[model samples]
Target: MINLHWVILLPIILGTIVKLISIKTAKKIMVLFQSALLISATMIFIEVRKNGTVLENIGGWPDTIGITLRADLLASVMVLLTCFLFLAMIIFVHNKNYADHLFFFLFLSLESLIIGIFLSNDLFNIFVLIEAATLIITVLIMYKKANVAIYDGMMYLLINVVAMSFFLMGLGMLYKKIGVLDFYALETALSQVKDPQSLILPYAFMITAVSLKAALMPLFSWLPKAHGTPSAPSVVSAILSGLYVKTGIYVFLRLQIAFSPLIDTSELFVILGLITAIVGFILALAQKDIKLLLAYSTVSQIGVIMIGINLDNPMAYWGGLYHLMNHAIFKSTLFLTAGMIISEYQTRNLAEINGVFKHMPAVGVATILSILGIIGAPLFNGSISKYLIASGSSGTWIESGLILVNLGTIIVFIKYGQLLFGSSGKKETADSDILEKAVVLTLSMLCFLGGIFGSELIAILFNVKLTVDRLSYSIKILLFIGSIFLGILIYRGLFKKTNRLAFITSFELGFNEICLSITLFFAFMVAYLKLTL
Candidate 1:
């Protein structure tokens, strides 16, 4: 039995060696390594499922003194997802020119860093891994070196660095107060403390940083630029939207658990999430670039996931977790398809490109399936997750907020669906490679199959059985249908006529402004925590 620790280390070690080899050799090695990694991750996940949470202390030292690697169901599931996604990504980009040795090296290193973040039981180790991943992603986003990609990369780097500095300060405070960096030890130590309120400053610092990382409202200015940068490879954009952002959400979830004894900020997060969702889609509705539209949609989905998890409802929590995975599949598919569309049309503007369905039927089908998934159409994955979240919050404002957000999502996608029809005067571009189509098709099928077996999937993934609420499900289906019509009318009446609000859509916060926003957010969180205490 291979130790779980080595799973995280092997990728980094192999990636380094592959970097020195020829590009062709590196590609072959990466494919094999990623395949093996997926199998190994699956084995680890199975072992954890059978044996319960697995733990290892590095160097044979005790948990309190040594670095601790742990894999609970959450960590194992995320690791498995990461492995599968990275392998799919490798396949997706195989025929593309971006498969040079340096790209693969950074890509594999990123996989290792993400795995490390999920598995690390030490808070400090998580911090370090996140920082390393941030640096790597910065380089990847700007690899093409065109059209403000450098500025986007630099902004991404600087903002995250500032956020991590806050995290480090919080880590320092945590160590000073609890005398341990290990999560288990910190929990025990925090429970014994007489004044839990004293931990508020550290909690505020860490969560503020996490909020930025998660791209919450007011701090999400960097997300569109980074994810939609003209120069970033489609696979990079997909990976960023699909997996990397989830790391922030994952850390946010962990932080909430770790700090639960100190504070219950669930209500605050719920409100913040609702705001993020509303703002995100509104911005998305105003975008002309296809990639930016998808990017902003990601911000909205992240917010919805946030709200679902923080609702303090178990069913909603499970739904939120499931949605995280679903968003990854559908959103990545959208980005990849959009990349192909942009490449073929020689333009990113949705208004100019037309007749994708006629020109590229397979890509069109994938795009439609993904659109169904995103809009919570009755038999898609989004419906299952959204239904679960709604059922968990019957008659609450949160439910209403969710509906509004869903409506906004529909409006944006309805506009996006415009790219699928009409006539393109130009001839069709080269057909997408077989592997590219396969990747999108597979994800689209998962979205369908997931909804078909939604209940069973939830039970299998989270070990929790849930009965379907038939009436609620019917109502949700009805609402979704209504929203589709409403979205079309709204788009035809308003969005089609005006480019008003173009400024808000194009406006980006400068570094100084972003820093100020972070500072203000930290202050607000601190104040809120004090008042509640």
Candidate 2:
């Protein structure tokens, strides 16, 4: 059996070796190495499923005394996701001129750090991995050094550094209280502690950092700048939005579990998630830059995923996890295809580019499919997970909130749909990469297949069996169609002729303002814990 640690380390080693080779040779080597890495990740996942969670302590030390590499179901599945996304992205950029050996070195190094985050069981180890990944991603975001790339990269770095400090403070507090850095060990020790109140401040400090990383409302000011930077490569943007932001949520889930005995703030998170979803779409609806629009959409989708996880319902929990995977697929397709369209049209302004279906039919098809998936069209992957989430929210105001969020999502994308119509008046070119088009189209198809087989996918992904209610599903289909028409009307009536919400686009938060929000969030969590727990 392949060791999980190798899956974490081989990428850095291969990246170093590839960096010394010529570009042509490097591409070839990276292709082979990434494919093998994907296979290793899959085998680890299979091993986890068959034999239960796999754990190996560093240097033959006991689990509580030494650093541990662990691969539970969630960790293994996330590792599988990491490998798959990296492989797809590698192929997507394989033939590009800018994807030089240096780029591959940094790319593969980031991959190793992300996989390490998934496998690490120690709080300190996870923090170190996140810090390393942050620096690499900043370099990637400023890779082209165009426009305000440097400023954006610096802002991203500073904000995350401050956020991670909170995480470190919380980690230190946790270690002091429980005398363990391993998550399971902390959980056990916390269970026997006399005072549950001692963990409240640590929870507040840690969750504030995680929420910001997850791009929750008010704390998400950095996401649009980082993910939508004009100079970043399309592949870099795709992976950051698709896979990177997800790491925060993944860590939040793990830590929340460890702290479950003393704290249950699911209700508070549910409210916060709803606010994030609403704010995300409102801002997304105001964007004119194509990539910025997609970036804000990522924020909105993250909110929906957060809502699902915190709903305190098993169906919604799985729905949230499934939606996380589904969002990665469709969002990556959107970013990659948006890059292609921007290159062809030589613009990122949504109004300036049109006739995608007429000029670049393949890219248009992929974009349309992805749009459908994101808006939760009845038969797309999003619809299934959203339906499950809706099912879990049945008979509650949360259900109504979900409807509002879905409606806003519909309106936002309907405005985006304009890119697929009208004429851009640019002559069609024959220079587009066939492999790039194929990768996106394949992901788009996965969106459809995932929805069609939603129940089966849920079972396979999480080992949970669920049967969708036929009558409820029928109602959902009707609601989806109705939302589309309503969205079209709203887009035309309110957004098309007037700049009613254009002011939203000008809204920006400075470093101090963002820091204030983080402080407020931490204080709020502390208050909530004091009152609730």
Candidate 3:
């Protein structure tokens, strides 16, 4: 089979190569370009049909000098996601002006960088692509004329750029000890490091860098504002909230898998994941802007995936990867649906979106199904991984915390339900775009069917023992109960009274950012201390 590593990078490279000045034709040309990508991705997905990993070494150098490109189960799943979601986004903006060449450039640039991030075997190359992704996405967020959008994008840039700095520094420090810049090299070397200072410092830096990108706990403040501010294309939002965030998580997963023995940090990840899950949902309850609420909810879900990785059980490990793919599917659906509502109603204020289901049946169904997914409705994608999260651990205390997270997820989504179904005292009116309807319906069906048959999909994607009947049963019932009763309870009790605007000025939010910065600074200091003292 022909290696399509270059195919992944083609759109961006070609887009930059052919920078046509006519914005009128830019959208048309961009769609054609993306169509090509979709084709390439589809073929690649088919090419890697077996439930295993594939590696292509570009330039045919020795394995040490070669740039290795791998299409494992994980990479194939992402390719399908990016292709579908990105196409849906293109359809969403079909009628609009694609006059800005820069937006198109950034959009495709992001796509290329994403493929690179996943496929790159070298740590330094991954770090470079990560930064490139951050740069383009920051610009893409501010594609509109909104000041809030600029503020959001700027802060996102500021925070993640610092993260990239940390990432590169970690690479440099690791190279100083291990004399290698590739992930395969580092992973091979990681198990051999004996010095506490040499090992701990680089690993710590890598973790912080990835944690910031993944927006776990303290590093999550920028996501809501940045993702919420711009009227991003449905596809851009999908990539941002879905796959881009996973880059960081992927980094974490690779590091942990390769360096698990060198690190005794599972419980540390658990503690942080707990905070991320709880705090994100709490803040999600406080949001009146649909985008912001969903953004915070994404943060919460990240914590959930993080929890899965932290548990270290085989079921939990695969479950985390499962949740990561599931989140990409369903959460992107939620964001795309929200984007439709915003596009139709011309607002992000969920307070005004009451009864949105009444007029737009397609959108209503989409919203409800998305909410169900978030709530972890049975057979749907979210529940499977979430169930594993709660049950993956052995301790009563961990189980109890997982329950709280589950309950919290249920409650916050209830807030979403209310926001759509007249919680804020508005009626759903008729204004359905065919494009929006098609996109939402397709994604909703994907999630719904994905849920009922995800076991098969999981088996095909990864050789894990995830069967439909095996995962189906009592757990869904308990979660559903929470989704109904406790959800309403949290909605009316704590969520109903929460303020949305306060997030910008809230002490909790402010303190979170300040604390994150301090933690990062202290991390740097510790590196210096580890070396000198």
Candidate 4:
């Protein structure tokens, strides 16, 4: 029988070859093969769940020497989610005029690369897969012929490539000292070396690199430009926000396991995360463009994950990981809904676009449910993860940080939710869009039900002991209510008083990135001095 690992690679290889046939057929392959792969991903995901991690070595080589496919519970969950989002995107793209076959093909290539990244135990493999993903996405963002798309994509590529280079250099340094590039191998080397400083340079390199990808700060400049301006098919919206950005969390988890020597950086992560959360929300609140608002919101949500990583408790990791899932689910829903809104009407400014729900009631309901989910309102998916991420932090100084995150998200969504009911939800006449309605209804269901079943979902994906205390529930309720109240106050009080500014061009954007890079370099030097001679 063919190995399931081999089974997974079959389509990727076929896709590479398909382009020689016809661009039209190549584009269609994303729709065709991803459907089969989705089914296969489900079956394997279930199998991996029951039997423990699956290790598939290519060319029948042993695990340590050969390229290996390692599917742990983490990979199973992430890759399955990737496939689901990809399929949903295919449906969203079905009727649109794709610029070329490359767009369609890249979708699967990206899907496969993401699967490969999650499933690979080898660090080098992850790098290759990640680079592949970055290349594909960069090209996708600039799929059009215009300069805005081209310039934005170029900036994204340059920054990401620099980050990726730093990460590689760090890996090379680690490999030089340890002669191994796999996570398990690195763990063994880390333990045997005894010189904790053996990893100062490499550890420093990777943290900075991954932080860039994860959009932790300073490294996050590309996120707004890349994601906010993409063609943003509904499913792609879901995947980029929900699945792609979470790779940083995966890197952090792996770092914890492999670079235990550098565990001290957890505190640093916490401080930087707090900074990121506050700055990101403030920037988000300042935006006039709706996509940019959501883009800044992405920065804030990632800050939430960093808090969990920095908190570094098993429970904190649990919450961080849990929020990882929730953010991906709801943020994707919001972005996709944003795409449909743009398609139905023609504007992306929250102030300009209104009464969309009137024309497309399903989109309206989806928008409302996604808003509720994002705000962590009662019984929606966003609340569960929000509680974990918040509970993952202390209820004191840092807790206020999480509250700010909620309030910022609520600020933007309320702007949209209120708009859908007013003068903007429709044009001259309110007409029903059955196709648009169906898509929105599907996502809206996920948004609502994800919250309702969050606890069970958490248990199924992660083995951490998670308990929902009454106090936890009460705090979340209070935070949600307080955020809504504050949003209203801010809208009435400050929004009317504030002027519009683009976070993208501001000095603050560069300031955050420079601060992050300086911090990472400083941490690296200190680690080197302390660990080495």
Best by lDDT: 2
Tens-place lDDT per residue, model 4, 235-352, is 5546777688888778777876787654466777787777787777777777766777778888888887788766856667777777777777778777877877776667776667
lDDT per residue as tens, model 1, 1-533 = 46888889898888789877787777777889899999999898888878889999899998789889999999999999899899989988888887787888788899999999999998899999999999999999999987599989999999999999999999999899889988888877887877867998999999999999899987898899899999799999999998899999999998888878868999988889999999999999989999999999999999999998999888899999999989988998999899888888899998998999888888899999999998988889999998888887778989999989999999999889999999877675457799898998898888898888989988877778987788879988988889889988888888876755577864778999999999999999889988897
> Between 1 and 3, whose lDDT is larger?
1
Per-model CA lDDT versus the true structure: 0.89, 0.91, 0.73, 0.73
True lDDT of residue 349, candidate 4 = 67
Write model 2 residue lDDT over 306-329, tens digit each, in one string: 989999899999999999999999
Q: TM-score of the candidate numbered 2?
A: 0.99
Could you estimate the TM-score for every candidate? 0.98, 0.99, 0.90, 0.90
Judge candidate 2 against the unseen true structure and give its global Cα lDDT, from 0 to 1.
Answer: 0.91
For model 2, the stretches where C-alpha displacement exceeds 4 angstroms are none
Candidate 3 deviant stretches above 4 angstroms = 17-36, 46-52, 98-100, 422-429, 468-472, 497-505, 508-533
**For model 4, what is the alpha-carbon lDDT of residue 151?**
72
Q: Which candidate's TM-score is highest?
A: 2
Candidate number with the higher lDDT (2 or 3): 2
